[model samples]
Target: MPVYTHGGDIRTAQAAYGGEVLDFSANLNPLGMPDPVRQAAAQADCAPYPDPLCRDLRRAIAAHDGVGAEQVVCGNGAADLIFRLVFALKPKKALVTAPTFSEYEEALTCVGCEVTRYTLDQDRNFDLDEGFVDTIGPDVDLVFLCTPNNPTGRLIDQDLLESVVKRCGAVGAVLVVDECFLPLATGGPGLAPWLASHPNLVLLRAFTKSYAMAGLRLGYCLTANQDLRERLGKFAQPWSVSTPAQAAGVAALTCCPHWAAEGRGFVEGVRPGLAAGLTAAGCTVIPGQANYLLFRLPGVADLKERLLTRGVLIRSCANYHGLGPDWYRVCVKGEAENRRLLAALREVL
Candidate 1:
């Protein structure tokens, strides 16, 4: 079997270390799934096959995004939608960032697309720069941009993103903006305001993050272009998202608005406290906008092993391209869990 590495792989950790491991590897909301959404899923129809078209769920998403229902496409998760986009578009050449989400490259490579990387400068705290797009040529057919990027938790500047998309559009390159981490950040509707004007733009979002539905596997994509939306629908398998997942998607989209606000506040409240704890242990915590923070600790390789021995599972960034073995990423969990992580790190370090 072909091997793939991705986030939320806590099962491996649990099996190796025991079942009660405290996971900081997955950068989820940490509040757990919303109770209302859970109730909705429990009450939803389970016998019949889901709507192949996902009409109701798409309509709910359209209502939430204030866009037409036809523009939305639901999937098993953002991962399913991402692969569909790659297969449907079939770009010859694509640009993505190193030390970012591994799935972007995996999807691109599976379709035989040539993947190029614009490395994030570690010394600059992995901040996105406008110049990264300067090297893109007319031959490049797609640009995968991750906002509030995974592991690093850094967001690209709005203006710089606009510049990239505008230039990419001029060259007929599809620009996919992965906003999976956006809900974790405190803000207004980001980049969605530009979707109406940027036809070449595609936005991928998920309930897996802020809504705390990681295992529920619910996500959707937004695009103003009816053609691309249709193409994604065509390429996607029918009823890829389950009935329970569809209901959860709607419930999470509608009922979780209030819960999202509280979750954001909860994440913001814990981020600094965790950062301080990491800093106190002599780790360099990179400032970030989302719920996760990146840090560099001396002997991180050894420290990770020690943490595992202590039943704490955190993401060691050694495998992420352009990052070194000394780097690690930790998600901001609730106060008690965060404290447990801090205590483990302090002891291990």
Candidate 2:
């Protein structure tokens, strides 16, 4: 497997590098999985068939996000929902930002959709500016955008985001704003309220990163467009969310109300020191609000492989569009882990 395709491939990395690896590749919560969530998931009854529509999970999500239960559609994960959305709509043309999530392009390509990429300039810290809003026109049938974008960890300006939503609405294009990382960012959630006004807008949310439930595979999308929301489930199997996952989602929202804020706080507290360490170790770090940092190690060769030899795994940005080979991403973990990473870097660099 191409390592850059996604992170948390400890099995593959271990086989190749021959030792236990500390994974900084996947951007999960520093708090790790909550004990309450674990208990709820472990005790879930697996004998009966799982709910095809994920009604109970939707109700909990709707209450947590302050939207109608019918407006919320649960899926196996954010990625599974991405494929379902693409299959349901099957848009002929799509617009996506470069250096964003890869699955958007992958899903769009599966439908033979001609994709137009608006590359974000890394010199500007990969900020999405007004020019991106201008790119949305009637010719584009679908658009995929990420706030607190993956790999880069930059959140799009709200005004700029709404402008894109308005432009997409005016052009009759569907806009999917993936806010998978927003719960852990500095700012609280946004854009779900916009669903009442714009039918073309879809907000993707997942319990994977914030709650560290990647193994649970619970994710959902919120939209006011009931037809499109219902159609999302049609393209996929009825039981997209498993029994354990539904219980976990409910427990995550109901029992763990303050979990996201705690995760955000942990990320906020450690990110600065982590960035400083990376800079002190001969890397230029980008400022971001997400639970991760993007940095470039100057004149470093095979940095990822070298780090692997030291039992550390980081997400290399080489496969990310609009990024050169030198760029890399690391999750904002606990103080000790962050220090360990820096110590390892001090040796490698």
Candidate 3:
């Protein structure tokens, strides 16, 4: 399978720039990983192999989401589950949002599936509208959606989302919604509650971003279909999740119910100032409800390099399907770090 380019590669930046790089490329929690999760991970025993089924972690996640344990399946990471779904279902055709996460297309192509794109309008700030539902048809076998979508950081409207889900079900197409960023969003109910009503709907989530556990490689999927869950498990490798990752995930969900809310509130509080700062620096900031913001400015093609010279790193959205070199994304970090980024942008711009 072809690899997808992602953010948060501080090692590469350090090698190239030879300095301390403040990365706004990856949209992770800036508050840092929780202490309880760290303690749990440190205390976990790695001498024994991890539970292949992730029994304890699944139960913890199920209890936290108020869903049945049978409805949940854990994976090495969200990416692992994404590939597993594509391999298991082997859909002939797939529909996905352009400029969203790249893995959906990569996995689909790996299975020799034909892919179609529904490009979101830049004029609309990349928001999904009612017209998206029209893109779903009987010919499509699968659909992928990312809420508070990557690169653009725009959430799907609840009404529009429901309409799309219903249309996909009617057409007999499976709908997979990526809710990895949902925990960092300020408001709106997650899609977990809809699992009972929409068996075709698979909700994907991870502790990588919300709990700052990216290195742990932990993620999960929620579905009401037992057969589908079984298929996913069959396709996955044995003991995919490490013992420490499972321990950390269980601890995170059990001990840090308020961590997500706290991170959301912190992002919501600081996002406005970040937007204002970027705008004053002469960039057109795309307003987002997530923990990150997408913006465009003149000479952005070279802006990333300029910021790198100053020990700051930002994501260039040019690689995302529908975005050009003019587009960029930055995480809404803490006050001091946000100010540092703004200062670097002001000088570079």
Candidates in order have lDDT scores of 0.84, 0.90, 0.91
Model 2 lDDT per residue over 155-244, tens place: 988888879999999999999999999999988467988899999999999999989999999889999998997788678786778999
Task: Output the number of the lDDT-best candidate.
Answer: 3
Taking all chains together, the TM-score of candidate 1 against the true structure is 0.96
lDDT of predicted model 3: 0.91
Score residue 43 of candidate 1 by CA lDDT.
91
Q: After superposition, how far is residue 62 of candidate 2 from its true place, in Å?
A: 0.7
List candidate 3 stretches off by more than 4 Å: 1-4
- Candidate 3 structure quality by residue, lDDT tens digits, 1-349: 6543688889888988997799998888878799999999999999999988889999999899989999999998999999999999999999999889999999999999999999999899999888889989899999999998987888898988899989999999999999999989867688888999998999999999898889999999999988899899899998999999999999999999778889999999999999999999999998888999999896668788899999999998888898889888999999999999999888876
Model 1 accuracy (lDDT, Cα): 0.84
Better of 2 and 3 by lDDT: 3
User: In what order do the candidates fall by lDDT, top score first?
Assistant: 3, 2, 1
Candidate 1 lDDT at 198 equals: 91
Of 1 and 2, the candidate ahead on TM-score is 2
Poorest stretch of ten by lDDT in candidate 3: 1-10
Q: Point out where model 2 deviates above 4 Å.
A: 1-4
The pairs that clash in candidate 3 are none
